[model samples]
Target: MPDSLPPPTPGEELIKRIAVRVREARKSRGLPRRVLSELSGVSPRYLAQLEAGEGNISVILLQRVAGALDLKIDALLAENMPLDRDAERMAQVFSKASPDIQQQVRALLFAHSQTELRAGRICLIGLRGAGKSTLGKLAGEVLGLPFIELNKEIEAALDMPIAEVLALYGQEGYRELEAEALERVSATHDRMILAAAGGIVAEKTTYVRLLQRFHTIWLHTSPAEYMQRVRAQGDERPMEGNPAAMTQLKTLLDTRTPLYERADSQVNTSNRPVKASLKDLLRIIEKRRFLDVLDG
Candidate 1:
């Protein structure tokens, strides 16, 4: 009998998987090997050998190739959770979709998924002084649901005030904490009223998760009213040592308007009493059935 070939080692199997994923991802995007090499800053010859499953590429080089192919390194390395052909094709299609179409697709998928992901969770989003805290508290009380301010959750988790957290961790660190805090909240609470920081929408991944997991309401007011309410809360920093504070505030409002508009609903609180705004907020919740979740 002819000599049988030896079985491939575990390392060899992993290299083969990586090779296939890289080649398939690159080809699906219509990227030539030379183009990929240029994008990844790895030699074309190395890429060629890697794709042929002969090269024992290092993790760093493989990471570069994965980046060039617009894939996570974990995607290439995962053994049990292999990407089926249909899913790979769908991922490519989704990557090229417009933002609006992508959002619609996400909403549709979330709606059809087995789990009630949103699960009666409601989030209020907008600039500070938009009555998120006030209305969230009031609505939670009336509806007999828990009310959570996401920043406060972060503060409690870190055992520090928000100002101290910001001072200690800087903005990037704070944002990381914010995202973690959001995840914690989502995992812990199936039904609650959440008031998120205004800037949460600036983080795309975190914001998308929030939208998918909660019925978000944009609590908005005129810039003037926003400033007035902030001052009324005994926060004088907005006007302290900033001659162009109002202008800066208006510019920020303009920049973030589109992001805030992505919320599932909006309540205008400009020139309105808290009680009246709370009524409108409650009406929106009832009219939109934000808290209703269909059983699987």
Candidate 2:
């Protein structure tokens, strides 16, 4: 036998380092799993696995998680070495960037992400009360595909109610579980309709994955309608006595609108009956498939 064993692969080393750094940052920041999950759109279970050095995370996902923790991607990926002056400067630049500038920078990393889609999966993306849950299920039934709510998947993964998970592990933990749940569903099922969380667009990396792997549709409605719908559905959180709640929500919508608009298809379901909106969405899907066949 040789005097020394073979060295670890580059990929293996990277995974180990990422596992350590991600866990360290989470603990240092005093962020629980749910909080990180909400911010990064990565699942707590997956983050747990990553911290355990068992996660096979992609660079894109890692970058997203790192950005959420306010770290530079390069710094996060760096091996167990002290940060050089240049690296520190780069991190500072990234940390201080305007939101628009940061988005533009991140966009460069996904240049080749959307060349083709998995064809068998479809995702609904939009803000809360956009009717993703309702419209997504109808679309699934019409198309004979299984309808999956991503939040429900997160709960199942954690074996607890979402609120409990959030309360126990924090938002970071919840998002980590959520992202892993989405990944599991994507890997396990070939044909399904996913009703993603309204804030899915906030995490560009996860949203990019959704866009690349699934045909995405934006279920859109007006701000007033969105609030009314959520209230009507008995989700009292939106109506909590914050007098400026509507203003805050509208501001959030404004910021996310551009991201939502990037979907492959869009249905503005405002002021329309459910049947009418569903019919319009079905037509969109059918027409797209017909065109896809023509291309093929």
Compare the candidates by TM-score and give the number of the best one. Answer: 1
What is the lDDT for 220 in model 2?
Answer: 88
Looking at model 2, report the run of 10 residues with the lowest lDDT sum: 287-296
Candidate 2 lDDT over 195-224, as tens digits, reads 998877877667776776678889989999
Tell how far residue 172 is off in model 2, in angstroms.
2.1
As a TM-score, model 2 comes out at 0.59
Among all windows of 10 consecutive residues in model 1, the one with the lowest summed lDDT is 80-89
Q: Write down the TM-score for model 1.
A: 0.62
TM-scores for every candidate against the unseen true structure? 0.62, 0.59
Question: What lDDT would candidate 1 get against the real structure?
Answer: 0.87
Off by over 4 Å in 2: 1-116, 290-296
